[model samples]
Target: MVTGGKSLKKFHDVVAPADAAPIRTSYFIVIFGSAHLLLSQLPNFNSITVVSLAAAVMSLSYSTIAWVASLEHRRHGGSSHVVDYSMTASTSAGRTFNFLSALGDVAFAYAGHNVVLEIQATIPSTPGKPSKKPMWLGVMVAYLVVAVCYLPVAFVGYYVFGNAVDDNILITLEKPRWLIAAANMFVVVHVIGSYQIYAMPVFDMLETFLVKKLRFHPGWPLRLIARSLYVVFTMIVGIAIPFFGGLLGFFGGFAFAPTTYFLPCIMWLIIMKPKKFGFSWCTNWICIIIGVLLSLLAPIGGLRSIIINAKTYKFFS
Candidate 1:
């Protein structure tokens, strides 16, 4: 939602610069949340197939535009901005913290792992045709797509903009105004689907707790109230503290690194019991160590960044 707001702002800046008064991001967040109130009502994961598909396409489209336009900018010498590849931070401590936070950002990119099981659950499985087969294929294809979408944007964008780039590459590109505007809209659409994908699991957990533990009667009323409340709570929080990069770094390392990086490897080791000091054992151990370190260190940097930003930020402004 925050990203969508930024995109909308970028679009507004392009289309109506004369009348583009500075709007608070919170308003855009509310608009984004309002759309989700309707989308969150979708019954289950399978029901959102079309939305998910469109989001995936939008992601690819915007990502492609980001890098391609970056290359064009560099090639055309669009700006006199000197591309400096040096460290963005001035001090050692700042550099270290930024480095750690960057690791969290990288970890955040793999956050789709959190919903893998839920998505697989939606797939049909039979004795003769297990779901894992198709799931594995899908996972491989998804990873390939991620690699394609992410790598060029990361490498080429940095190459072009260097350390001066914004947290969002789209924000840094200026010329080709219409294209940038379109890319921002694509980002908005993509994040809408991404938000729903991440929220579906939380919704399920909330509904389960209410139905099983609290003994709420299972019906549309329960779902409506529970899901609406969940959306509103998140919306309120977003409005309150919409620190995009900081939040990504914090949650990425705090929540995602364990599940995405190490937990699966640990589970494999425990279930398969690979021979001690063997390749699989050693690899998994290495992964665990790295993931553990990421989980421990990244949040500190993220928190520090949030503090630094919060010092200047106005509440809901």
Candidate 2:
């Protein structure tokens, strides 16, 4: 719930919801990728710093991907007009079961993440509202800045640990136990923040059900009731799932198959006319290919570990 809240809220906005889903997903990818850039070299994240770090990251990704997607749309014969429309992909039996193999999950997860917003991101606009600020140039510049910041850090991290790499930065730093503890603390806090931000809407979803179906009034007392139920839901996930890392490892790895890697380029392809598939299209295709490759490898790792390590996977294991 905590991570969900922060993540959800970071991308959350009911008013201009069309942008929310892709923005949220891209936010995760940008942060995830940026953290990797620093992994080999840099100082660890403290609470305050990570907040700023993530914000800049979110901005960069939101801008960069938005620009690239827009450019793709424009080149494809649509005006670079953008709008926020929400869409969801199926996660049930039909398309769901075939995605079970970690290999399968890779395909699914990748597909799912992509599916989360594939329809909207590449679609051209209706000719109505004035466009918002142009983010591509600014965001492109930001990615360059972030990349410069990250490259050195990755090497440093590698230097700190050669063959015997620790699981986290803190574990490797002998004297700086504080750094280790602080980084963990930031991540924990961030997770909580993301959950609250993300799942709060899920709570509202539940609340509406309660108020409408159960005949509760949609006021303070109802809100409290809804919140309490939401809290209970959190407890269940925490207790039942215990740690979500393996779960995310499995799920994130799982979703990566369809979502993180495959879907965007595919969507672009669908909307793209031949004249549009020029240099950037080729670049994105390479990236999509690389991501798909990595995503494929990841699911195998996840499935093996998920099957053996995760008791939760016993149903499948």
Candidate 2 residue runs with Cα over 4 Å from true position: 1-133, 137-153, 177-180, 193-249, 276-288, 308-317
Worst 10 residues of 1 by lDDT: 11-20
Count clashes in each candidate, considering only residues at least 3 apart in sequence or on different chains. Answer: 0, 51
| Top-TM-score structure, candidate number | 1
Query: Number of the top candidate by lDDT?
Result: 1
Q: What shift in Å separates residue 164 of candidate 2 from its native position after superposition?
A: 3.2
Q: What is every candidate's alpha-carbon RMSD to the true fold?
A: 1.4, 18.1
Q: Report the C-alpha lDDT of model 1 over 3-88, residue by residue, as the tens digit.
A: 77777777777766676577777888888889999999998999889999999999999999999999999889874577799997
